[model samples]
Target chain A: MPSPSSTKPKVSALGSFIVIVWLMVLAVAAFLATVVPEIDTLLGRSHLDRTVISAAQAAIAITTVVLLILALSIMKEVYIGRKLR
Target chain B: MLQAITVVLYGAIVSAVSFFAVYFLVPVMIKRLVASGHVVQDYHKPDKPKVPRPAGPALMAGIAASEIILYILTLDSSVLAILFTTAIAFVVGLVDDRKVMPGWFKPGALLLAAIPIIVLGAHPDHLNLIFGRVFIPLLYIPLVFIVIPIAGNTINSIDVLNGVASGFLIIATIPLLVSIAIFGNQDTFLAALPLLFTTLAFYKYHKFPSRIFPGDSGTVLLGALFGALAVAGSSEIIGVIVLLPAVMNSFLFLASVKKIIEHRQVKARPVTLLGDFRLAASKDKSAPITLVRLILADGPLGEREIGIQIFKLAVFAAIMALASIGIQYYFLKDVIR
Candidate 1:
């Protein structure tokens, strides 16, 4: 393993590479925003659109519900009879 | 379907590219600048052994680049609300990282950072439902002040262990991406996806027994991202939930440290002497042990012991994640169907 001092040059190089990637992304987003249609018809934009939206909402809703249940369940198991940790 | 999916996929690609490009650039520039001025400025040289040279400047530079890309891509008042809140935090952290600002100044900086969210209408509110009333906003501005900074510090706290804070970053963004897909918030999703990808890539260097520490800049970036995403999604409660792991860890760490300091003060009798001794003793400790001392000094434990404590925290967080998923399932399964 490289010592701490030895790591800086490698990190700096990686940082440079990340910056290049970021610029490329900007270029692509710009190009796509201009050249490609905002909504795609072939995939039946309306249907997939709703599906995507539902997926997003469901994911959040599910995540929220799941976390609460898990936390409560764990709390009940770990700290129920005993005082809270 | 293929075309739309392709477009979304392409958007993800573009986002990833842009975020990395900018994040990498700022650090190099900062490093060069620092190198030029190295003779004048005395870098932090410790009396004790140090681990990796502090990557604080590099992390700050990366944050600056990320913020700049966020601003450029999303525009001045874009939906990437977390970007600016985090930027404010980063600025505060940067000041501290450079000069070790007085302690009270940190909270003051956080309070200052919360202004953008309040001004931008990202304040938290709860509904008061009686009879037919709907969406009645209450106690919002105060809540925004309390919550944003708390969340900001939460991200800062879990950063104790390597790669831990980034784990929260990845977790918190899941919903943002989900919300974007469902609500046709493609613009926001496009913006966030890159940040997520960049963090993942950076994690390669940041994983356990780490190579590079993300430092304050990375933590602030994440906190800012959480804040921005909360505003854009218009779900303050969910925002807090997503960040529960980090927030809880930070809170626990603070309480733990506070208790330790108080205990030490009591032991040392003259409470003032405790701080003085700690300030002096910090120089004699191992670098990693210093991290433990600063953050987890409720009791003196070895590295393995600290790792266990961290693991317990992670498991605790993982449970929270699972619960969050369960709760959403209960309320929305029928609707989703």
Candidate 2:
């Protein structure tokens, strides 16, 4: 029976957290591109190989998809054993 | 001149085909859904208004047909990829509409929908940035899997009110089309037109006091296509920026509820209807937060007013998206080869 007005702060906190998370991701992606050598530049060196970049990208991609899929599974069970509302 | 005119005329034919398909079929769909008892009650009203709920099939048919025509004209692999991903998204939604699946099912199933794009060789490995000056390669394929589901769900999450999904899409799509055409992807440009026009046709019936709901099928189909268009056009940044509001709605909902349960599944309602049918924010601590509830925080507002507020935010995001294009063209001007 909590009044609706008091519920604002908690929701606001979550909203701010998510928006910040997205912005942080954007910033990081932009930063990573700035710092890391372009793939072709790295590939031209006798010592450097495309496989290294491919492996890194694959690792990041797979980990993100895995984490997201896991999140979805957890959300489904949030109200576990409860009847459909 | 003649060839340009031919493409123009052909584009017109494609637009007409898409528009009329959704336009003519929606009324029949409303009748059929109502007759078949596939309806949902509008809880905000005292009358407990019931609305037909099968606009998805009509939308899917229109989009599929128009995209096929675009593919016929261009023989673009990207065009075909868009059609398949969208149809798959629609079917995934239909599964939910026919019978409730666990909250995870649709998102999980949508992952497979990205396969057609990859298998068709439509997605390329390279990220365009700083006006196409900065290229990050080897990121596209993995990102494709993430983009499809996120887009489908974001669109689904924003369909809380009547016409919001289709209307918001019209605004969100303007920049997508602009950026695609300017970026010189003729096939994706032509492919995207059908989506814009299709949503325009559906918005006619989906607007306030709606006769029918887009349901999960309509929303997810549109969402997936929007994402697919971005992927195909190689304009993921533009699409993401244009859809920021809907993405925020998804983020806000998930962060608040800490789960993926349906809106109807929430124990406490986010907004409460007053005697005048104006919706006010819910005070219950247990009620999950939503964009509507957050908007209602200042005071109670009618459903129409709330819908307008969401549109206003979407337009602002569209402008921001357009600005990114401006930045690209200005800073990346030399790369306009």
Q: Which candidate is the best by TM-score?
A: 2
Q: What TM-score does prediction 2 earn?
A: 0.84
**lDDT score for residue B65 of model 2:** 88
lDDT for each residue of candidate 1 in B1-337, tens digit (9 for 90 to 100): 2357754665655565645654564345445544654212211122222234234444434444554555565463543355567677777766655564554555567877777766765443431111111122433465566656666666665665555666557656666455435432444555556556666656555555454455555565566556655554443444554454455444333433443221112222111112111211123221212223322323233322344444444444344434444444454445331
Provide the lDDT at B57 for model 1. Answer: 47
The TM-score each candidate achieves on chain A is 0.35, 0.39
Off by over 4 Å in 2: A1-29, A38-50, A53-85, B1-3, B131-137
CAPRI rating of model 1:
incorrect
Question: Mind giving the per-residue lDDT tens digits that candidate 2 earns over A1-85?
Answer: 1123322222233234334434443444454445444544555565656677656545654565466545634543342212113
Q: Ignoring the other chain, what TM-score does chain B have in each prediction?
A: 0.64, 0.96
Give RMSD (Å) of candidate 1 vs. truth.
15.1
> Where is model 1 more than 4 Å wrong at Cα?
A1-85, B1-10, B22-76, B122-138, B179-185, B256-319, B322-326, B329-337
DockQ, each predicted model: 0.02, 0.09
Model 1, CA-based lDDT: 0.46
